[model samples]
Target chain A: MTVILNQSFTGVSIGAVLLLIALGLTLTFGQMGVINMAHGEFIMAGAYTTYVLQKPIGDAGVSLLLALPVAFLVAGSMGALLEWLLIRRLYTRPLDTLLVTWGVSLMLQQLARDIFGAPNVQTTAPGLLTGSVSVAGVNLATSRLFILGFALLCVAGLAAILRTTPLGRRIRAVVQNRDLAEVSGIATGRVDRTTFFIGSGLAGMAGVALTLIGPIGPTTGTNYIVDAFLVVVVGGIGRLRGAVITAFVLGLLQSVLEYSTTVSVAKVVVLVGIVAFLQWRPQGLYTVRTRSLV
Target chain B: MTTTSTPPTAAPATEPPAGPPETPFLGRFLGRFRTPAAFLLGAVLLVGVAPLVLSDFRLGLLAKYLCYGIVAVGVSLAWGRGGLLVLGQGVFFGLGGYAMAMHLKLADAAATGETLPDFMLLYGTEGGLPWWWQPFANPAFALAMTVVLPMAVAALLGALVFRRRVKGAYFAILSQALAAALAIWLVGQQATTGGTNGLTGFQGFFGYDLNDPINQRMVYVVIAVALLLLMAAARQLFVSRYGELLIAVRDSEERVRFLGYNPANVKLVAYVVAAGMAGLAGALFVPAVGIISPALIGIVPSIGFVIGAAVGGRASLVGAVLGAIAVAWAQSTLSDAWPAGWTYLQGLLFVVAVGFLPGGLASLRTVLRRRRTSSDRVGATKGVTT
Candidate 1:
């Protein structure tokens, strides 16, 4: 029973991480038709950013806090530059965008390897969240629980901004109908740039969040990107709620299966199962509005 | 075909002043040598003579290129003609390669009289071969499964995704994510799937000594024949009615649907065929290369397949085969020359190809023809005074 509880806790923590990583991809894919295959590289950038900032801040707590915005800025700027220099030209040609972004991803991965070497960098969790908590005879890692809460807070914050802010309104408008929104005096080009920045920034934040739980490495992002993409797809295009639900469900399924079977088999089974499921519901768990005003 | 005459406005250029000079037989034949049939003949000659001209090592390398060409043809069918952008061909390729590799590994183990592979013993796997892996001990079963399994998976995937109308980048991303997941899963399953080390150290293929020059040459011949057959098959499909509909779906899915045809079915058929071709290529790759690892079937390699197809002229069947072979050859030569710099050179090639030659080398003739005609017209206009 205790083992079950522990597994569930771990599953939730993993789900939280998956949610964070996938959020950016969801936004980018939803707003701009570009798949942004380099989104994983952005996560790597954030991880590296966190790793670099760790020494300057000294205190673990302060360093973690400082790494958050810095990662956002660094990754966001890089994403913006990629959009300006390469991605913008490939619009409407999604496959071309995918191939180009893949090239960019390779370049970023090689750059990271060159700069940081191939070794995994160590990171420390804050003392406040590092220890375990005993709850109902189940000892759960405090850091993981904090991460789950932090992820929820981030999601909620983003949701609120999307619902309440004028900029959010503009983004939603463009997502719904780019031509119509453009004709309505919305500068869609500006919105596209800003959306890409915010999406990439979120990926960076996810990276910082990841270091609190485990080690950072050049290829660490590759580990999570697949799961993130699965979550985004299962959640449905352009739907935040779908991503969250799918992430949690997949996370729980994977954890439970890992407990019952080997991790590798569990993963293969889950992937096969998801592929089958997507065949049934290719639009994903939810279908966004499809009324093309243009 | 339409029998409409050329427009009067376009006729002025074709009309000669009094009588146009007839081209000599030699000139006409020389010009005819540039035709598609001539190109096909030249290509066959070049490939056939390469083995005799190049060293044994280079022949083996070319054989590897042929294997990639087989897979590239499949990629072109699905991505170039069908517009599926399947970014997960690696998963199918890996499946086929691993299937063949497992059989070879088992055969080697049996010959050595070992209960388990050396790596398995080192990893402390005391148990006998896993139940699922037992079927692969039979060489014939392994080969059959290698071809069937990937096709089955692809068919299932196509039926599901296409039925739900998941086209464009969504489908591409989904497939790529699947490839990435499969690679990681293979890497993580150390005991059963051989983990990151993958399946290697095969000594023979069905009682034939793989290291013998005769066997090596036989492998090369098999690869060449298979590639030629696959390309011929792809060309036939391109000219068929089904092929026309496939391209139609790609250009306008809704329009195709309105024309009393199921676009999804058309795309699905092409997708399955492509997957089957990829699987066959992969099965052949194992015997030719004598190794199959997770590294080869990962996201990067899958993208490499797409890059080759794109660079070769995805729409042109011959271009698909030639482009894949050329890219593989370049990669081998570049890696041999400068291991570290090959990746940068590859990137530059992709950038230049995408920017300047969207139609790839296959369209080079068309571009040249356009230029030649333009220049000839310019000369004709200037010669009016003469």
Candidate 2:
């Protein structure tokens, strides 16, 4: 029972990171239908932002706090620039975007390598986040708890913005009916760029949360990108609630499976399970109702 | 992915219907024979000129590039002609390569009077060969299994995925997941799979002494001949009636459905055929390269096929072949000079070529556009696509 509780806590924490990484993908990929292969690099950008700030800022704790919003802007602007420069041109052709963004991903990865060097880099966890606390006879890492709390907070903040704000209304309108939204005087282009900014900024935040647990490298984001993408895919295109539920479920399933089997076997099993699940529900957990004919 | 993920109206203005290009009598006459002419020239270059001009070492490199060219030919048919982005072809390639590799390893073991591969002994396995590897001991069975395994896997996956109407980025992502899963699985099963180093240290290939330069040249000839034959077969498929239906499905699935055609089955056939070609490529790749590892057929190597096809012109058989060869050649030469520059160059090349190429297959885009316009008219009147 103790092991179960501890493992589940670990699982939920992993799910939190997965959810965070997927949050931005959910917006750009889900709502926009653009497969941004380089979104992973944006997460890398965020982690690098945290790394870059620690140089001048003496206090690790203060730097970590300041890094969140700064990383968001850094990654968000990069996404907007990508949107304005490349992705915007290939809106009609989604497959082309995959190739182009893959190219961009390679360049970004190389850029990271050139700037940060090939080896992995470590960050000092703040004094507040370095330790653990015991709860219900199970020891939980403070960083894990922080990540969970941070993820939930992000979810609430995103949900609030999407449901209540005017910008959210515009995003929904653009997503539902781009032509109709345009006719109604909504600039779909700006909405697209803004949506990309927020989505990528969320990915940046996810990156910030990632450094709390482990040392990050240039390819750190690459490790999580596919899993993050799977979350978006399984959750359904453009459905926040579905993404949240799916991420947690997959995370728990992975930890439980990993506990029983080897890591590689666990990964293979999860993938197969996901594929089988896709077979049963092709439209995903929560498919958007669309009237467009192909 | 989807033409547009927009929920409301499709907005037809975004997808401008294509009209047929005006071709004169001479152009039509030339077009009729250009495909065949292209293959003929390719055959001459590989079979006749290559052996005479290039050294054994250079010829060996060409043979290896031709193996990738084989995979690219299938990519042309699947992605360019059929519009199915096959991102996980590496898995199929790995499957076929492993099958052939298993046979060679078994042959080597038999020659040495051992029941286990050298790696198995090093790892201290108590048992003989694994139950799954028993059939691969037979050379004939292993040879057949190379093509059969990958095609069977493709058929099974195609049935499931296509039936569900899963496509576009979903299909691409699913395929990539398969590649990742296979690589991870192979790495885990060290004793059975030979682990990270993969299956290597082969002395012979089908009774031919691999150490001899003469036999190596013979191997190159076999690869060149197989490549030519496969390209011919693919060219035939491209011009076939089935190819037309595949295009119809790509251009407009509903229209094809209305005409009483099953889009899933059409796609499944193309996918299976492509898998068969990739399997052959992998089988040939094993003996030519003297190794087959997860590193060679992982997510990155899978995209290499796409890039090759894209650079050459995905729709055109000759273009895909030459494109693959050129890309492979460039990688071999350029990476030797400056390893880091090759990646940046490849990335830049992909962005520039595919970004400007008007759907990564310029000729095919025009073809699809024209086909869409005609299919619309025909669907309204005769309820069929030409």
Return the top candidate by DockQ: 2
Pairs of colliding residues, candidate 2: none
Instruction: Give the range where candidate 2 chain A is weakest over 10 consecutive residues by summed lDDT.
Output: A285-294
Query: For all candidates listed, what's the TM-score of chain B alone?
Result: 0.85, 0.87
B31-59: candidate 1 lDDT, tens digit per residue: 66654676577457645776678777877
lDDT of 1: 0.79
Residue A124 displacement (Å), model 1? 3.4
Expressed as tens digits, the lDDT of each residue in B130-230 for candidate 2 is: 89999999999999999999999999888998998888788888888888889888998998998899999988898888888888888888999998898
Question: For model 2 chain B, where is the 10-residue window of minimal lDDT?
Answer: B6-15
Instruction: Encode model 1's per-residue lDDT on A18-99: one tens digit a residue.
Output: 9998888888877776778789889999988888887877788888889999999999999999888877765645566667
DockQ scores of all models, one per candidate = 0.22, 0.50
For each candidate, what TM-score against the reference? 0.88, 0.93
For residue B92, model 1's alpha carbon misses the true position, in angstroms, by 2.1
